[model samples]
Target: MPRRSRTLTGLLLFTSLTLTTAGIAGIAATANASPEAPAAAAGAHTAHKAAYSMPGMPGMPASTRASGDDPDGDGYIMADPPVTGVTPSMEVPPPAYFHEFQAKCAPTHTAPDDPIVYPGQPGKSHDHTFMGNTTTNANTTTASLETGDTTCLAPGDKSGYWMPSLFDGDTKILPEGVQTIYYKSGVTDYRSVRPFPKGLRYVVGSPMQTQEEFKNLKGTVEGWECGDSFKNYNFPATCPDRQDVQLNLRLQAPSCWDGIHLDTPDHKSHMAYPVAGGANYNSCPADHPVALPMIEFKMAWPVNGDMSNVRLASGTGYSFHYDFMNGWDAATLDAMATHCIKGGLQCDPHGYDENHPGQGAVLDENYELP
Candidate 1:
């Protein structure tokens, strides 16, 4: 994986623009898989991620964070946010949660008749070793535990293989209604998504009308190229690539949605149709469960050498999530208005679900969204 060389100035400016335009927070998430050669955990580890800090909220101090760490043994501190008296709507039980799910989620289906092939083994070569790009022996209980069952699956964990650990064995997976925006590693899909900042277009679902209602929003958008072609392994086409291009931006919306609630549609069932005579348009679900007015975008790609900026390359994606306060675009805004009104939901900053929490008359601080 390569380090990006974007300056704080561009990130800061984009952050401001995103916040104002979307009435939401801006955020970024990064993922890095271990190197290709197998080595003991004690071996020299080169894989690493850079640190990032969010802008301060009013009445908040810069040096505030909770004590404790992630029980998953990822080596990163999973501290509580600074905002006191606040808790996420999602109720993820602590360490006990993992141990419990491990037993329950254990797959009932028998392993495939073929022997598991470990990737990156010294003299012994395998399809996953080179093409999948990781040194983790894909054939052991430890690997399963580390990867969370077969969900530890290399690129396309989202769909293929039916790994049970990802859901932590909980029968309740994110509702099928949840939709996810995807950039399939290969394929000329670039034409389907446009760069941001050309100007935000109102999504068809917003509850608020009138230019006046949306007066305060603004954002910036960019796109990254994932080399030139698509190839297949055992994974799904939508899996993030190790060397995919990245797009980063910040956005903000007006007061009407500020502190307002929005709904998140069940994106899984939505139909994908290529846009008019152009590219295939994937129609997102028209309605969502929660209406949210703001969101942030962050993306990353794998680079062979040290990288300070975007470069044409071939690889997979890490992770993409949001920071509820900094950025958002028109599509999110329209959904916010429409869903908030229809679902009667509110914005919950501490929400763990994919959408913002805290709004709606039935506001349950402990509720979790997918």
Candidate 2:
């Protein structure tokens, strides 16, 4: 497959907002592509609820694959293999009282393919470092995600997460630390928050635009930071050698959904952030009323003490953006939102709230709840 630069470690790369559909449904790949940096290839928006299928692999006849997540009887392996029993446990934590829970994820792989943007076309998209689901690629569909193993502490969270890669000249910088993912209520009435819809996916930052554009854009929680600094627009010119200091970025996705259309032509229209609803409550807009758990990505990288020669695969730090595809088991995810966010307690990836130890979520050593 024709491809871009890919490595185990990827770009701390961030920044970009331009996204456009490259091809039509069931689009076929070719050597020639548009002049624009393939970063513009957002997932194609289609009229059908079913995502567009990719070309089949060699020797893998539709009937030859093992039975898996394909509950729809498509004769394809769509889910992860069955999981074995795991031990139930909880983590010790300090007292806290916020309706938020967090999951930890590590980078799994880097690749040029994006199932959402350039599905089925292995080498067509920009390079990205992926986490959560380990087997993500150009052919990865929402169904495929269900059956894939995850790097996240939450095993049920087979969801796919990825962002542009970072590089020091030619050397790819792997994310040395875990990405702390938080699920919190975006509105004042935490009771109204719901779990993400099955197969729901969206892009969080605009890569096509410049760093300045991303800063003013809505839904951005932070740009880049080093230690105590919270407003570094791009990669810091130089990082300190302290334990607390490291290069990292933060992003927040919209918490309100239209309750329909898993995707749009732009891949972001179906979702919206909350607005003032009066009476001490923030509410989803009239058009998009469903309140889902707001997602915040706190990603950390290994690079520090660098004077220069750093850049993301997309562009500079400003081009930073990321993507997420829901793959959590419906019941498990719902229980988390209900028990934690709705319960108004701070929980971990395992749904274990320190203050509410009695309500600990049953999970395994890997931190995933069955």
Candidate 3:
């Protein structure tokens, strides 16, 4: 696709309003001097009723009741009552465990030719910032990826992940210390979670105008924030004076899979995000019972100034999306998922369990990225 320019005023305005409202609510709750607060009392009542609700995923029923009665007896009823389930355990892999990986920043002229976009047409897609497998391109296939050299710390890993390029005016900015961290937590039962099946491919985020939608609206884990503090997704952060405008783009892949299809026609129908707010928050759907390690991509770019001039080949900075092609050895990937992720142990790039030293796979200290 050809490069395009976009405006961010609407997104910024919506974000600002949301933050302001949240801040006001916090202040109001704090300023209320009455120990017998009505809001708190109401919340306690709702929480008690929510305990008995059935478990369900988004767009699915949590209970047999067509709808539940409004706790306050108001005419409008709330969303399906929250369901009950285990929450996924999450942690950040340490920097010491960073894999010895490297890839040159790909120019717009070198967009990959993969199933996610321009599947059979080379040069039909926009430029992307690629990593992991070095030979990813339009002609890459499952078989080709299996035999590809990987940039992962683990020699057995051949997965490839990439996102749109970040540009400041006419200059392309590259991410620094491009580290990939793995997490094993999900809302589903740990026993049901599994490693990514080989050859599975999918894309997260969108290249369309809807890309500007916030995480809650999109129902996906994606956002833009400052590199220094990547957690603040409420708004796009600004850099302090004299410092480069370093921004972080985060896209978290779906952890729930259907267990049957390695890929669907749309490349996404078989996968779903863990529910966000029910008793089953972050849990997988019944149809997609296999819980997999959640893969999150955080790309930090140096914009160097105001974002007004920032644009991506897809559209605007907010139009960010990413692709993932799983090429892991099935046995090794499964073991890592079962022993490290599901085991609730933080592992290094080589799959070494940091919690229990000497356990899990060890990296070749002498090995370097090709």
Candidate 4:
């Protein structure tokens, strides 16, 4: 994939008094519009933002910073700055918990058998490991997702999450254990957290940039580690003599939304991340007021040495990106967010359901790679 680029231009137009009056009249006529009016407005704004690239903006590319710029100068990028000052919301009671669920991995090839990949273009895409819904694809819609079969231990979860497949030569490597999903608040203000609206979709990270570009570019989140005991994001982790090296990758999707648009034309402008300074770590900007649960991807890939042969469908490890399509039922998602997340109760995988007990169930817990 190639990096997307666009030139920014500024123009000053002088309108005649007669034209200006006409424009004002049109605006006034549309001021008291119907509920559908906002959708049109959001679409126009999204289109404009896509045409003008804004580097270093939150939903845009990350800003250039030197301290963590591959401090060790190794080929791999490091982790991002740790999230600080995350004081759980006091309004919510103690024991704020996460809803855990396990799902089976699906192949991400474009082939017909690979349902998660876009339809009709099989060989065009590289292999990826997917989880969540079993029927996701290019033609998948919000309605279709609601009705699609799920891979999650809890049959109710239909949302899909996926990343590039780890490989050694032509063989694919699966995680040592079942891949788990942890849904919790990234900040203390749990009261403001909300469920992901149905049909919401977004992509984090870039597939076109190189390792150097990923390391130096603003907004890119990539890192590596050895074993499970990791310390800082300054350097790649080193594996002990017998253990496999791991890539500790984290990609945080934008949480704040403009509220009206399920997705923007740029697929990002409608959302924003919490700023790094002071106590505003999870604060959403005024324009993007509605706060949705932040989706953070923390993955460990067992790829030890010689990354030269390690390549993703996008590029290399540094070019990692993932796609999410919301398929969760509205009421159930809302309850989990309100009761478990906001209420600070670590509910089981069944997600606040009374019938299912324990910490939910793990799907394919016994399954292993061939």
Separately for all candidates shown, the number of backbone clashes (residues 3 or more apart, or on different chains) is 67, 22, 5, 11
Candidate 3: minimum summed lDDT over ten consecutive residues — where? Answer: 21-30
lDDT of each: 0.20, 0.63, 0.49, 0.46
Any runs in candidate 2 off by more than 4 Å, and if so which?
Answer: 1-97, 362-370
How well does candidate 4 match the true structure, expressed as C-alpha RMSD?
17.8
Worst 10 residues of 2 by lDDT: 8-17
lDDT of 2 at 142: 79
The C-alpha local distance difference test score for the whole of candidate 1 amounts to 0.20
Model 4 ranges off by over 4 Å: 1-124, 209-222, 228-238, 241-246, 276-281, 305-308, 351-370
Q: Once superposed on the true structure, which residue ranges of model 3 sit more than 4 Å away at CA? A: 1-114, 209-212, 217-222, 227-237, 241-245, 276-281, 358-370
State the TM-score for model 2. Answer: 0.72
List where candidate 1 sits over 4 angstroms from the true fold: 1-221, 224-270, 273-346, 349-363, 368-370
Q: Write the per-residue lDDT of candidate 4 for residues 23-109, one digit (tens) a residue.
A: 111111111324653354344334322322333222232211111212232111211221223332323324434432222333222
**Which residue pairs clash in candidate 3?**
1-125, 83-279, 88-186, 113-137, 113-138
Write candidate 3's Cα lDDT for 1-370 as tens digits.
1111113322332332232112111111012123443333334323322322223311110112111121222111211221225334332323222221121222112242333443434444555656667667765666777887765556566677777655555454555533554555554345546667666776665554243253443334446665454444333435443455466665666766655445432345456666553554446655455677777665666554455666654555555667787877766676666656655566665556555775645344522221
What is the TM-score (0 to 1) of candidate 4? 0.60
Candidate 1 lDDT over residue span 231-348, tens digit each: 2111122323444332222222121110111110110111111112224322111121111222222222222222223211111211111211111223432333333322323322
